[model samples]
Target: MTTLYGYYRSSAVYRVRIALNLKGLAYDQAPVNLVKGEQRSEANLARNPQGLVPVLESDEGTPLSQSMAICEYLDERYPEPPLLPADAEGRARVRALAQLVACEIHPLNNLRVLKYLVRELEVDEDAKLAWYRHWIIEGFDALETLLKRELGTGDFCHGDTPTLADICLVPQVFNAERFECNLSAFPTLRRIVDNCNALEPFQKAAPSEQPDAG
Candidate 1:
């Protein structure tokens, strides 16, 4: 069996859940309790040196770290209901969109970075929120423009079918809404997210629906 170690609200973990659902794979979930600092526990650190949620363990004897790498592993191992497009150009475009969110948006808002603001830099709640909202708006604006202007977009981020881009998009949108980022401007992103939610797999994988959601 494939075992996923993750925290419900962790956007990194959220990405893995979306990939698992999209691939139509059955796997067991083990909540890592990120807020409680369990991710830094020896057990978790053994699986992921970065002290991060979403370390995917396969029965094949290797546990994977990094959500994107784990996602690609699933894509290669399963090879059905493909998560990437067939054509090379389409695949690159999809991966690019996914990277724009996973790399550009997520890294800045990481929990450790936020904690540093409060503990070291002495940032207040309002200032911390401002920092978070600023990044979301900037990232989302660029993402929305790409999605709306690109001819590849249809019912999903890359095409009518869910792909790597949608896997990255949904988790980021969930985080954005959680932080109360005003999303009224991104109609295209909202439409794609709404379609994703309408599916059982995506809905089932939502943070609120997870076994560890609190």
Candidate 2:
């Protein structure tokens, strides 16, 4: 059976869960509690030297890491209900939007990075919150511009159906909401998120519904 090693609220892990659910794949979850430091344990380290989660173990026993890579692998392996666009240009657009969040915005705000800023760099709570909100505002503003101006956007980020962009967008939205980032300015982002959440696959993969969520 396929198995996913992940933390409940991790945006990266959330991406894979959405991908798996969208693909109608059946997989067992093996929760890795990042908050409690289980991700650094030997067993986890053996599976992923980076000490991260959302590791997908193939039924044949190969392990995969990185949320975007995992989602692309899933798309290639199970093409039905594809998470990418059909044309090369369309696919590139989706990937560019996805990476705008996954690469540009997410890394600065991940749990480990925040912990280092506070514990190591001695950033106070106010500064921490400021850092968080700053990134959200900067990223959301640009994303809003792109979504509104682009002809590719339809009912969802790229088209009527969810694609890689939606998968990345939803989790980043979750993070922003959790931090109480003001979202009134991002009407298009909000609209796409609403459309995505209306799907059963997206609803089921939500952080609140995850087995390990507190």
Candidate 3:
């Protein structure tokens, strides 16, 4: 069977979990305690030199690193319910939405970055939280505009069905909520997240539902 190495709370890991569940692919979870620095351990480094969570070992024993790559791989391998749109333009839109969160928002607020601010740069607790909230608000504001004003948004970030954009969105919203980021301004983003959460696949992939959740 396929095996996933990840931490329960990692947004990137949460994304992969959702994608796998959405594809109806059965897989085993091998927890990597990121808070304990297990992601930097030698074993994890052997699989992913970047030492990131959500390393997916395929059923054929080949390992895959990076959440986006893993998600796209799963989509290509199992195309029943496509995560991307059929047309090139639509696919580009979906990818842009996903990258807005994964590349812009998430990287600035990731655990490693936060640790660097507190441990290395010596940022105070309040400042650290402010740093996190600032980026989330900036990113979500733009995301909300795109989702609300742009055509084709439905229950999910794309059309009526959940797609890659929705997979990236729900986890970011969860992280924002976890940090108590004020989300009243991004009603459209919240609505899409609410719709995604109502689905069984997304619920099962929630951080609270993961085996390694504490």
Quality of model 2 by C-alpha lDDT: 0.94
Task: For candidate 3, write residues 1-214 as lDDT tens digits.
Answer: 6999999999999999999999998999999999899999999999999988889987588889889889999998899799999999999999999999999999999988999999999999999999999999999989999999999899899999999999999999999999999999999998899999999999999999989899
For residue 82, give model 2's deviation from the true position in Å.
Answer: 0.9
How big is the positional error of residue 152 in model 1, measured in Å on the Cα after superposition? 0.5
| Clashes per model (N, Cα, C within 3 A) | 0, 0, 0
Q: Where in model 2 is the C-alpha error above 4 Å?
A: none
lDDT of the candidates, in the order given? 0.91, 0.94, 0.94
Tens-place lDDT digits, model 1, residues 32-136 = 997889989999999889898789986586889999989999999888889999999999999999999998999999999999999999999999999998998
Q: Model 2: which ten-residue window has the lowest total lDDT?
A: 53-62
* Whole-model alpha-carbon lDDT for candidate 1: 0.91
lDDT of 1 at 205: 84
**What TM-score does candidate 1 reach?**
0.98
TM-scores for all predictions: 0.98, 0.98, 0.98
Query: What lDDT tens digits, residue by residue, belong to model 2 across residues 1-214?
Result: 6999998899999999999999999988999999899999999999999998889996568899999999999999999999999999999999999999998889999889999999999999999999999988898899999999999999999989999999999999999999999999999999999999999999999999988889
Q: What's the lDDT for residue 116 in model 2?
A: 98
